[model samples]
Target: MPSETVVLLPGTASDEVFVRTVFAEPLSQVGAVLVAPRVRTLCERLTALDNASAGHPIVVGGVSLGAHVAALWAVRNPDRCAGLVLALPAWTGAADGAPAALAAKASARVVADRGLDAALAGTTGWLHDELTRAWHGYGDELVPHFEEAAESVAPTLDELRSLTVPAGIVGCTDDPVHPVDVARKWAEAIPGAVLTTTTLDAYPRALGDAVQAWQRAKG
Candidate 1:
């Protein structure tokens, strides 16, 4: 009856701060230790996940590109994954023209051609603030990280169906970049997966709902 460990990664151009803000309290409520690694690259995020699960099975999850990476890892290492808590899943299989991917690619170009401020100038509200902090934290690696995430592939529907672990997929109902339909598709493909909807302003609820879904599935 040991407490579970939840290793979460941030979205593209994001930092551990965002992960902690969204998942830490909810995971603590369920007596799970939260590991939010501050990583700028996909490889680092995956390595963090692998390292965290080396001792025992852990719940693996992330937001957007982070979610895609975590899901891909869980598909490959089901034995080391207890469950998933995915948020704002952007796409499946090939990223291609997925809105989130396209945005990342465009942002990368802006960052490369103009500057960080120019890339972020169009964003507003909470997203603006979040990106401002995260993009700044990325520093020299921002553009490359954005490009990598833009071109990254998520777990295919077949891969998701092959997963034996429970999954909790969350989506922002009004988010254009991370379509709710994508989350729905993920939930449908994964056995015993739960789909929850919430707004960006109440994003933390998405984590709570996801954890509750996992707990329900485990029970």
Candidate 2:
């Protein structure tokens, strides 16, 4: 609707190159710009989008930590957004036992112990098959990207309670980094949020379906 411009933000250890190759190709047909801001905070990224669009209806979305940022942005700028598309949203709160936090801690350990190379190697295996291959090819640059993402967003749950945007959440059943329960909580927390599940094999399908749904609703 209204010539949607979907700004896509990638999760930790990800950058615009990955998002463009993985997500933008399919999404661009719908007239989405797929704006991937390279910033340290969600607020700053949203500010950049604001300046770029100059007050247009934007559909914000992302993966993992990026999703968390998008959700926060939607809450803060409800009127400026058309919809939210969250894929593998991470945990954000005092809930220390959430899968997201556990994974973050585990990843932190990997980075600390085995080093970034080993960490990336291990994680590349755990990612979806497509992503794993892509990451493997880009292994040389993966660590730096992950380091930048880790320093980008500081997860805080209290800040999420303020969001009230229509959202669509997509997650993998086998993804330990983005557990289903955590995704469910995010869907429940945001007003008019919808949740969908997929296996590692169906990631692209899930993403396309979610984006289409959000676009239709925005119309």
Candidate 3:
């Protein structure tokens, strides 16, 4: 596998640090350079993808809302996208009532009405830790960013069907917010896209699965 630049974005309210932890090692194993852009809003994430693709076709990917953004970008800019590594796709099109969207909205409200610590109270495990770090990182922009993500739309099935690049979609069967069915739908819609599943506790393996799927599709 030749060296390639892979631009990966973090989930809604998630920072580059988390994205790096998820993809950096797997990408390194394939000699791919991982560029985890620090993006706080939808516009920033899209802008990062656009800027990264200026020189060459690059693999674009992300988790949850980030995955939705990446897929939409690839659908519109197929020529600029070498491949896709979408994980935890939350919804097919409009975010109306989507679990992830609702979760974001609820969290936003909690953060707004109470406070960051109040919103995070009683949360434990890796997700809690990650959110603690990322939410604090957002500071004043956190609520607005959450609202933006809650209102955002992902690529429609028809739009996804138009994508020509090889794609690797990952899902967690136990994750209610980002259903595995959504991931399967994405794989089924995009031509030659591959689907893989992993538990939340073992999500790091999903990146490698996605990369391998992309390679298999390319073959």
**Global lDDT of each model?**
0.87, 0.63, 0.89
- Using lDDT as the measure, the top candidate is 3
Stretches of model 2 off by over 4 angstroms after superposition: 39-47, 123-165
Against the hidden reference, what TM-scores do the models get? 0.95, 0.72, 0.96
- Candidate 2 structure quality by residue, lDDT tens digits, 1-219: 456677877666555555665567657776766777665444555566576556687788877767766776666676877778778866665435555555555666675677655655644332545445444554555544444444444335455555555667776788776777777776666656777778776654455555654554445
Q: How many backbone clashes does candidate 3 have?
A: 0
TM-score, candidate 1, is: 0.95
Candidate 1 lDDT over 56-172, as tens digits, reads 999999888889999999999989999998888999999879999999989989999999889889989877899899899888999898899999989999999998887887888
- Model 2, residue 168: distance off in Å is 1.9
Model 3 segments more than 4 A misplaced: 204-208
lDDT preference between candidates 1 and 3, better one: 3
lDDT against true structure, model 1: 0.87
Q: What is the lDDT of candidate 3?
A: 0.89
* lDDT, candidate 2, at 11: 67
Whichever of 1 and 3 has more TM-score, that candidate is: 3
Clashes of each: 0, 1, 0
Task: Pick out the ten consecutive residues of candidate 2 with the lowest summed lDDT.
Answer: 122-131
